[model samples]
Target chain A: MSTLTSPDVGRRTTGRRGAVARVLAAPLVVAVLGLVTLLWLQSIELDSIEKRTLNTDYLVDRVREHLLLSLSAAALVALLAIPAGVLIHRTNSRVLRGVVLALANIGQATPAVGVVILLAIVWRTGFTTALVALVAYSFLPVLRNTLTGLAEVDPATREAARGMGMTRTQVLRRIELPLASPVILAGLRTSLVFAVGVATIATFINAGGLGDMIVNGLKLQRYPVLIVGAALVAGIAILIDWVAGLVEEYARPRGL
Target chain B: MPKPTTIIFPSMDVRGAASGGSATSGGGVSIELDSVTKTYPGQDVSAVEDFSMRIEPGELVMFVGPSGCGKTTTMKMVNRIIEPTSGSIRIDGQDVLSLSPDQLRRHIGYVIQQIGLFPHMTIADNIATVPRLLGWSKKETSARVEELLDTVQLDPAVFADRYPRQLSGGQQQRAGVARALAADPPVMLMDEPFGATDPITREKLQAEFLRLQADIGKTIIFVTHDFDEAVRLGDRIAVLSERSQIEQFDTPAAILAAPANDYVASFIGSGAALKRLSLMPVTSADLSFGAPASGGKRPQLDPTATLRDALDLLVVTGAEALEIVDADGTRLGCLTHAAISAALTQSSPTRGAGPAAGEGVHR
Candidate 1:
């Protein structure tokens, strides 16, 4: 019996260790990638690439612009998607929910590049058009995740809250939303990463980002610039994903 | 397994203990339902029809019936969880319909079989839900949570900060009960609150629940399909049938002795005599048989044990009689199988009265 009980204790200790390792693993990988990128850039003789892409002023400006566009689009998507999902969930009419879900599906089903090009044609290409296209592209995941999170809350818990005299708003605020936080954050994380990847297309309309380097490098046949530009974009994506992971860990409900 | 060195009996005279316990903080209001009926839309028959009963303050009345018999519907209507098609409900002589549903529920405690403890919340936070809703101070709410944890026989130190998943089924159910009792509501509605626990755990919870009720004395309407549970905890049972119609309503002993109809008799099944033995305390039976048997060892029975337990002990020990003793180990009297049988067969009108066993007779 003592032996039988000992394994459970061992498993619990290992489980905690596993969680800690998971939290550390993402940032460690990103750090290693950053060090490799720096060393590889140093080893290669690419003075031309260094002047245009690796310079402090050029890299910082492009990276800042990339981050600004992606963060804005993600914020907008969250604002729209979460409430839409909640409204769809709270409404009793099947037709209404069906209609909203159908629209979301259509938005996601359409190709992202097509959405960006179409917006560029009609609304004019630039940061604004790119932001709008990114928001539309990122909407589905956030909305779907929000709906799933709210739906996943145990019905018995909702009934108990109501029976305990909580108003509708109180139930949503104190119980439902807190329980749904981790999933919602996961949705936001996906949207943010998608937005970062999609923002690369904004350079086609001269929005000025690492994408500018890639498009220019391609046109000018500068392989060194192209490599650094592509590497930087990948690096930013990984960095943002790591940051979102931290947010998710912090936002996860305790004592669950 | 280690052999037991001591036997702790179930509390005797639960009613007296309950009444005494409620004296310090008294707040129970009588409830009366007048010809209550509920019929769902498009349904041919009403779910519950012409349901009416008076529940005295601080009493635990169990609604016992088969599934889909509308026992839950009737109870829900009291807190307006369900609206009755007809009839009025009054708590403390005030019409329940006059108050808003949320307002009415604030004063009524509800516990369900699923336990429904919020997975995101700590045990203390779960218990503090209603108190916080009612705008109690943080200090007051925390104190109440601790008090309730203790009341349900859970340690506040070990459980307050823990999550519901950290607890066993029995512990979770206890926390559920504690949550219901948090705001000290005068009335509590329990829908098979311990139906999910295993047999051993359920028995322990039932015993603990009885002691808790004995202390708090809240007016409780408990719904369950288990007759044994109803008999163990209810002061009176309302046996309902299809469409929430009342078949028989009476004390467990009264129902066991004389079932109102064949339906009730069938529901009771067999072994009612043995069931009745559980209702009366061992002291209630005449245990005045003269002296213990000389020289030979005999089994001991606690005075707090029921007559049914005494009968089983006599058979198990293969003795004509056993000595009944109090907590102090002092011999009270001898309990014989004949006395238990006589007590079971007797039909005395006085409440809890039983047959008196005669003095010593050699086996």
Candidate 2:
């Protein structure tokens, strides 16, 4: 009897070790890619146009601008969409929930570049338009996650909390939220990564970012600049996702 | 297995000597529902209509019926989980509707079939929910958590820090009960608290719950669709029909011996005689000190064992009689099928004689 169960224990130990390796693998791969890009750029001689965009100062500024746009938009979505999702969930109104969810669906369904360009066309081109467009594009995942996370709490668990004399608010704060955190965090992680990708479109409206390098390289036919810009953005996306993954792991309630 | 020979024996008078009593630990209070009725809006039929009953202090009354019988609705009203459309529910003579629903619930223990231990919280935190709600000190709450885990037979050191998912179904159920009893409330409302477990686990849980109730003696309203569960665990089984109508409310032995109507009899189902044997101890029968049969050793039963257990042992061993032993394993007497039958027949008169007759034998 004991021997029959021993393999399960061995498998479980190996599975845990595999999970640790998986967690570390993303950053390791991104680091190597970043190093390779740096080495390739160092080896290649750049023309005047490529040199202009490929310098450390310009590259850093574009990366800074890119980070500012994506991070702010993700932050804004987190602040607004989550509470709104919660409020809609608490109201428990079918019509209200349905309407909000439908609007969220439309917001997400619209292409990211289309949203950014449409907003810039309608309301002057600049950083603000890109921010709003990014927020709009990424809003649905966090909002939908919050609503679904709250909705999917076990009814029996909800009832048990209420049955134990917890007020509705107490139930949400003490029981529902903690149980829903994993799914909610997953949604936030998705939106953050999405914001980084969508922020690339910011360069179209003269909003400064790595996108500028890619666009300038493409228009001027400097493949080195384009490669550098595209490589940097991809690296940023992966790194941001890795950091978010760490936060998610640390913040998740134990025993879930 | 040999087909045992049948033995005839004279009937013995064991009426008024059955096992039913309301000895309490003084932690429970009386609950009264006067003309309680609940009608959900837009639904013409009432879920529970004009339901009224008086539950004595420390009594475990079971509301037993088929599904959709409104039994659960009736119990939920006591804690105001589902407020009554029109009725006065009093706990220890205080009107429950007057108190804030949350405050009212804090004082009433509640458990359900789902065994809803919070998945994210440790067992200690789950058990401490009510205590924290009532503003108990952390030290006091932790101590109480430790005590309750021990009470439910879960080792406090081992289980207190474990999450709900880490526990087996039976352990989770124990945690659910421990969580409910955390604040030491005077009244408990249970809705099929053991219904979700497998049969063997359910039986073990039932026995543990019975032992727990005896020590704490909180006036409990336990609801279940399983009639055998009702008979085994209830101090008084309230057979409910549709609309939460009380068909009969009396001791399990009384209900088993004498069902008030066909509805209750139907709820009792078949083999009630065998069910009644469960309520009676082996000592209730007039055990003979006759010599054992010419064979190897026969199966032995404890004196505290029930007549049903005695019957089971006899059938399993295929013996005409079994020896009843004391704590030291010394044979007290021989228990036979005839003695078990006599005990059942003697207790059968209280049947159909109504709740009063049942209560007499029960007390």
Candidate 3:
């Protein structure tokens, strides 16, 4: 009987593992193709023209800044939204959930450049302002997913918890969180990808991240530089998504 | 049930053992409901109405009838989960309505058919809910959790770290019981805790619960719609009719032997004789090793066996004298055909009240 059980558990793990693997596989191929194309393009930069040439060091720094921009914001949202998400779900307080959810959606919909511009006017234009704008832009996906995942949990399971004498908080902490984790993680990945893509536009403002390379390359008509910067940003988004997939896969409830 | 030919006499191994076992920690409290009524405002009829009964503390009593007989509604009133519109339920000579709902719940361990364990908490954490609510310290709560798991026959080490979803349905139910017992409350209310399982699992849980009750001695008011379960586990079964009508409340033997009215009789359904044997234990007085056949070459059996079990032995082993031994293996008595018959017919040769065997029988 015990042996009969581990296989069922194994099959579940494999199923989720397969999903993460498939998602990662596509991004891995994309990164490799982008890498080879960049290598070939760098070999043929024509002339000492007063044009923006691809500076490897600048490119690396911009990539680092965008990475920082997306990861820090996504992490913050995940931590805050998961608990709030489950609380709303267990209470089924649609009114409260709807309010916060609308705020998050508004945050996402309020154009990224506008947010950066507004934040720059209010605060000093720097990495910190850039971080705030990125986080705000990324909020809706994570918050919405957390709410939807938690709400989707089976009510029979919740009824079971109440009947067992679990307090309201205990039910959320123990039962609801574990069950809703996968869906919430999926949402987190979506938000991270969005933040990475949107962070490129923040360079239009003085909140200089790697978006500077793309914006500078565009103005100077430096085609190679622009292509490399855009390619790097795309690669970063895919990488963050792959990493999120790994974390989520590892953390999905064992029997899920 | 069609009445069985078996009439096994109840053993005098210890006559007053079962009844006197219900003293509990304090003096017994008789639970009463006087004209209690509950209507959910817009609902057509009241869920429960004018329901009343007397339940002694430490008693293993069950409320049973058809679905929505208001047995559940009535049980919920005791803990104030479902408030009664008008009635009085006194615990230890004090009116229960005088206390707050949370206060009342802290004193009552509640279990339902769905064993709602919190999946985030470990088994130990789930078991510690009520004690911590009652302001117990960390050490005290931890110790109590371990003790409760043991009481419910779950190995603390094997179970403590696991979440509820990881457990089988039966295991979850055991954990639910452990959680309910956390505060050592005098009253435990169960709403068909075993009803969700298959018959085999349900029987196993019921047997284990009965053995646990024997040890803990809590006053349990169990609500189930299953008549067989009511007869097997209840010290007294209270039969309710549609809309909270109290048809009868008496010992299982009395309820089966003499139902209070036609409603009670219909609720009793079929197969009374074999069920009666389930209540009687085979005693040394009733054991006859060499009755009507050879006493050897049969599968060995317990002399303290219920007539229901002995019938199976008689069929398979084909031996008259199955060894009647205690767990220590001392022969108590020979289980003869006569005793099995006596137990079923509601005929007690020695003592105690019987409905058909005496004048006080319900007419």
Which of the numbered candidates is closest to the native, going by highest DockQ?
2
Model 2 chain A is weakest, by summed lDDT over 10 consecutive residues, at: A1-10
Q: DockQ for each candidate?
A: 0.36, 0.38, 0.16
Please give the range of 10 consecutive residues that has the lowest summed lDDT in model 1 chain B.
B3-12
Chain B of candidate 1 versus the native chain B: what TM-score? Answer: 0.88
Query: Candidate 2 lDDT, tens digit per residue, A48-85?
Result: 88888888899899999999999999999999988988
User: Candidate 1's C-alpha lDDT?
Assistant: 0.80
Residue A38 deviation, candidate 1, in Å?
4.3
How big is the positional error of residue B322 in model 3, measured in Å on the Cα after superposition? 9.3
Best by lDDT: 2
The CA lDDT at B120 in model 2 is: 75
- Backbone clash pairs for candidate 1 read B18-B214
**How large is the interface RMSD of candidate 3?**
6.9
**Alpha carbon deviation, residue B188, candidate 2 (Å):** 0.8
Cα lDDT tens digits, model 3, B257-332, are: 7677778878888777666666665552356545334534545567546666876676676655455667887756
Tens-digit per-residue lDDT, B1-363, candidate 1: 121111111121222111223222544668889999999999999999999999998889999999999999999998888998999998878788877787678678899999999887778888888777766656766777777888888898888877788899999999999998776677899999999999999999998898788777888999999998988898888899998888888777777777778888888888887777887777767788768647866789888788878888888879988898888989999878877877766643343233213111100
TM per candidate: 0.87, 0.89, 0.74
> lDDT, candidate 2, residue B314?
89
lDDT of candidates 1 onward, in order = 0.80, 0.83, 0.70
